[model samples]
Target: MRNHGLVAFVITTAVLVPAAAHYLSAGHDQVVKFATATTSTLELAGAKIEARLEHPLVDPGESLRIKLVASSAVGKRLDVGLLVYGSKGDEDDRVPSPPVGVAHKTVSIAIDAEGNGSIEIAIPLAGAVENRYSPSPFTSYEVLVMAPRAATKLDRLRRNSALIGEGEGIPEYNASASKFMNLYSWRHDLQGEDATLFGEGVVARLDAHTRTINPAIAIETPSTTEVGKVFAVAVTVKNASRKPARGLVLDVETPIGVVDGAEGIEALVMPDNATFDLDAGESRRFQFRVMPDQVGVLGLYARVTCNGDDCDDDSALTKSGTFDATEIVKAQVVDEAPSIVGRK
Candidate 1:
């Protein structure tokens, strides 16, 4: 997306729709240094509000999720207007083009007592309908073979099974090709416009691309252990998301050598950090009681959170709780391997 006097992000994905890019005529006019760091916070109209992305993760022709929350200090209550824009960066990694331009949806979330809302959307990508970049968005199968007439049902079932051959490459490729959809949000004070901190005339501001909310998790499991040894470790998850994170579950992945202390490997251990809800700036530590069966390096990691059954593309939210993760996106979201960051 381009405008003569307009500035954009140098992002990494492409826009699928030609009409996706357009002019951002917000009238900032003055050349301002918009922060694109993905980790800062912005305050407006007596309300401290923040926008966060669960994961820039998506399939080709899929939507990305963005979280917006607002809260007043103590006494004053405020109502605000929020404008959200999604865009794929240009070929250049520093300057991004226009928004997806696919009819931006309008949603309102009032801020009185830590009000929160979320939106899941697709980031447009520049790719052909049959191009490898967007191939078979529905099938999620690189190869679909139809068998003889009599076995059609069985074959059809097997063909679409995610475990057939590729575990997750289909969605992985699509997410990677698409621009991962970076979020740029602008907040307007409903009652009035405040003076610009940058000095000069006033204007509503898009969130500095750099501001983000993510969890900082610490997994503490023994580095080495013996067979049949009952061991316990704790996962401390801090909500750096700037907003409250609700329906959050602390997911712990046990390596092949270990199993839950109560239930064996396949057992969905209940009441052990499965439910997590935290407001901005809140942290909680939970225990993961486990038994180290056959010994080895039991590499465990605490990641993955969802509001429903599905964990990925269909999951309500997913975030990589890494300080250097930059963006909470699944495109390159490699879970942080458990390590002794410190004794804690």
Candidate 2:
């Protein structure tokens, strides 16, 4: 019997080790890679703008930034206007408001054979400065590089540009930018959990909410319980996104009626965009209590919010489903009699 138990244990461990290793390896491959690109004649302001953008990357706060250099492709002198729009379609208009915490300054440059340029402009992340903007999982913006054609000589005002690293005569000017833009469209799964303490005693703890592109709940029980007993519950949240998520909110609901002090405590607060940040490949735990008042089946639900405002309003944001709580029965009897003193 002992040998059979040992063999079973070894077999379980062997099966789980490879599974765990495979998951870890898959996670490692999901890290982001930063690259650069250049472009010429970027259409802007009803005209083509001659310029190049360098070292563009999706920033930590979920915004994009790049170094820009502009000049006239034509040898003739002309005025240049550059604008950054948040859409890919024809309504190419400047962002209604620059993302919060970003500083931007537009400068005029002379177009010479060598491509005269000015200092790089830095645009900060939107909605961060005033706490007004909500985090968005799918957002895009376009940089319009525009140069006016010479009034007398239409052919003299050229707006040719290329990504910085690509060598001269690279057939496609905007190929690198196009490729990077494609990457922006890819989405990833995210999952997380958190706990909060509420009601009379500090014994109550709520679980952290998990956020993922897919709506699902995974719960793990660490220990067993009896009926009518109060115990601690720990919840873990996982971020399964290919990219990081900001401003996360999680809520858990218990189906059982309040025992003594377990009422009106349904939500767990996570680090908001204003608070602690959860990076990709990260997980957090929340602890609370499960106090059973009677012996019956119990149900628990967990809802998650990520990268958006009004987490409770599904119309404006995304949410996950409920996680069912484990059921346990109450003790049959209680010992009430006292024992004799010193009677062993």
Candidate 3:
């Protein structure tokens, strides 16, 4: 949970552990990546803003569309500037630099007097994919969005040149009179006490996973139920690829209330290291027994992973080909159960 004022980067790469009550609000190339859809919200200066994706997964050649919505307490049209940069790097490695493809994009956002406005941008990810020779080339097309000190230098940037469209190589300046749009340096500059005075920008990231094949995950649960009553959650995983996949695992998570531990929350059904093999077109189903303690909406998250392998003969030097699929379902917990909740 890294936050620079109001930036949210929810990395959906699932950890192969027995998670209790982990909630999820829910990508790719040959060595293409895919990412689950997500949303981030934060406050910039006195403005409330959010960035979100409508689709759950995206791949190469597809357009990554993001919707930016913002509202402020101010009583006038507010103008702000933002930067979009993309790069290719290892999924595990940090330090993203050398902006890929068309350098980056600079745009201006205007919030009306009502302080409500939205902007949508679609970027083609063809240039963001990295071709690798490694047996299991784990690479990520990292797309970063930075909105710096909204409305400060937007007029100047627009006056210099049309900063809304794409650009070529990394240019030092947008126009002859325009200063540089260095998001990396601008972020450090805003870390001072005067950051709030000039307003702050948000940084959002999207990643792609490289794999030979992947699995499809699905979960089924009731819509409404009563507190302290048991309900069953069924999870299905299918290998839709033509090749066989090993190291297959599935995990289900429920809410572990404010209490100390997992005393009477949900029963432990699936083991942590419960790995199996699924041949081509094979599918498996698992059921989890759940009981809600308090009354409210309970979020159920399930993730399935396949080591969709490309490794050595003995599989000693394993090529890490990990494709994680996740799904989220919500069950309403009321004082009384519906007719459907009485079954099983």
Candidate 4:
């Protein structure tokens, strides 16, 4: 029997910063600084939101301390809220928290003398627990300080600049690239069945060219099956993109090993054309059969890949979970030699 290579799908989203003008009002003005000695500027609703990071980067579960200073000649008291967004790649929108490992917090700061004072904000990293067994590469996040609605035009300008500016306090965006490896390693409790079995390793770098829109996939199977019987396995694919994808390949892996007649066992490639194009929000399903050789334990994993080459070998972009299998029956052989004894 030929050894079948595992079928794996790798999907990635490439992010691009458009050349469009910044989202700040034209007359607004503000100055923000970073604690790290570097300076960056951002414009929001015509005002600059200045931000600085107390540290260059923080590990998961660690507090990210930020210093924000907003100024506006139209000075007025206003309430502010802070929000964080995460993206798997450039093509993905800045999505909300929880699933994306994003979060939000609020604080009240007064713009003092010189039209500027600092507000210290600490953000706690959530979802650090899930990063253990399943690691996510190409993880990126952005911080935003909201502008107060009741402030005067001048105050709005000052608040916007101060809030979006690229110093120490503003939303400084970063990714887990060469500068950081397995940035979520601090969550040791969830790394694997045991930390020693799967030791800490840097997540594989994702391809920079491919773009991911939703960066998510799901799998499901029948809840019940008898021992030594064959059953159908269903795989569902969701297209989170506005544009249809072409030459897409979906790969499913089973802990019981490759099922006979299943495609892509000899090579990573699927046997049939199996290629599909999916429109935004569209879903499609594929079915395969599994005949357990023995009863004990079973699992199924799935992944979606575009153009064959775009996938992460170690990322949870591939799905996995276990199921129970039992041996309820025993086989026995019977003898038939009674006829000869009767004749004698």
Candidate 5:
């Protein structure tokens, strides 16, 4: 079956990472110095609240630190609670598996008689072993800060998935946060202490580094080809991990009505579903010759995965987790059978 999700991801990445070559060419030091952290601010009941990540990217098996600061016009101690949840970088927090993974921490800022204070908290990140399964190389987290009373309610809602059934929290918090953010609107839904304690809150995002290995895939094809003539297409898979990638299955999908029937061309080509092994830092290139009978555009899609069902458990090859690579190639098919110039 064709994976439209993979196709969409491939298309979007191609358009978004046009400058990736330049970015990757930089030195390690230059890459490490790149700034990637963000900060957010909100206002509630004459108090200015700010939230930011102390370090946006945490190594695996470490903790993510976030710093929160608030300046209140009212000279009294303010209690604000922060609820944080995480998911794979590509996945949305609305549906977090094993719902208990959510992190909840409450911190109080002592607003002095002058009303100015800030505090920071460290949230422990889950490792592959801790999660009891292999995880993606990157994980993203969302942080929501609200008054202790409102935060407690939201935390319960988030943990139990009560507000929006099971495995969904985005919509519930989105609605609640929107209502609680506005001074005039907070009273409509929230009661006395809850409404009064609730102040302006801020939302923030943080990304954690879980792994270092990153495999890559590339597809090449001519822009135009003859309808009846066999044309060349190439697919390359590279393993960037320190260990070899075993049980690697590469699946290529062609437009309807076209077959891998290379009449006379001679080159190594991958079948519809080809399984192969790639060593560390090595790349494998597979070629294909396609002949189209109609004159129009043809699209070729390719997807590769490691440690899938096709791979056995010999224990020789590293079965760390599943790695995927997807790409699309389009070529215009032209009919070259007409001899109009000579006939005329």
Candidate 6:
């Protein structure tokens, strides 16, 4: 693991062996060429604003920072927030407000008389993903600056823009101001032991084979159970690989009314993830108690991660089990036999 308060940088762009956990200090982007790197941008007449992340490739263990720069013939500013999304379209967690979801960090930028200025924001990796139990790797997040565009009188007021808006006071407003939006993305993967770099256009990827330990899990008992009944189910975790998996974790997702004992083995309650370790060719069974409230079949999911940190790939978080479950039939009482006897 990298120390939480150390300062580091990537000196080269060669293929790097992913490192363990580490931390980085501020002012990490010692060398940044803004205008040269941004091949795309959204700009207003005589002014252009672009947002760029310090590094295109980042370590999952460290925080992600973005620099918003603006240059123009005149001095102007915009209220802005960030939007981060996943490659698989994981949009549950985002920053700022809609269209970016709910986040509280909104900043304003002011350019100098020379028409150049910069403002930045740092997104801590700890809670970057809202409602996520733990972070996942091989996952790329798109970061963009979301600013309110001056579409209408109300929009310009809320956006706090100097630009004019229709129906407010000006006859024609600059609609382009409301439309200025650009997106940039980078991978959250591991790099050399102490540092992670955000390499523009290059994503550091780790496959399952990179992990020394091969792990698997399956339902070993109680393939079927009755609804509204308390039952015990077992899932055996196996290390199919020949090497030991350090800081291993089991990420299990099951429907409601069903619970697992896997909650603690050193666990983080949110997202329902667990952490542990396994040796070469080792197998262990974990028991979970289930109580199905409604009738019908329920689904089960499980995966083994060497630990879903920047150092490991979020492999096999797939459909591991789809066991069957049944519900008890309700019974109804019959009327007294007197009516039936008289009819007979």
Clashes of each: 27, 39, 10, 38, 1, 9
Clashing pairs for model 5 are: 44-200
Off by over 4 Å in 6: 1-39, 44-46, 87-105, 125-137, 149-344
Worst ten in a row by lDDT for model 5: 7-16
Residue pairs in clash, model 3: 21-254, 27-34, 27-35, 28-32, 28-33, 28-59, 29-32, 29-33, 33-209, 80-151
The candidates, ranked best first by TM-score, are: 5, 3, 6, 4, 2, 1
lDDT of 6 by residue, 104-193 (tens): 355777767788777877664322332133332223344544433312222322243224443455433244333321112232342452
User: How good is model 5 by TM-score?
Assistant: 0.43
Return the TM-score for each candidate structure: 0.27, 0.28, 0.40, 0.30, 0.43, 0.31
Give the Cα-based TM-score of candidate 4 against the true structure: 0.30
The TM-score of candidate 3 is 0.40
**lDDT scores for all predictions?**
0.33, 0.33, 0.44, 0.37, 0.48, 0.38
What lDDT does candidate 1 reach at residue 320?
48
User: Among these predicted structures, which one has the highest TM-score?
Assistant: 5
Report the C-alpha displacement of residue 246, candidate 3, in angstroms: 4.1
Among these predicted structures, which one has the highest lDDT? 5
* Candidate 1 structure quality by residue, lDDT tens digits, 1-344: 01113222232221122223232221111111111112123454444555554432223344334454555534434333333333333223232223322222333454344443323333332221221222111111011111122123222232233321233343221221221221111223222211232112112232212211133765444433344444445556776655566666665554221112312221112223467567778766665444443322333445546564423432223444211110011123469988867665
Candidate 1 regions off by >4 Å? 1-215, 257-273, 308-317, 321-344
What are the runs in model 3 whose C-alpha is more than 4 Å off? 1-77, 83-94, 97-182, 185-215, 254-275, 292-299, 305-344
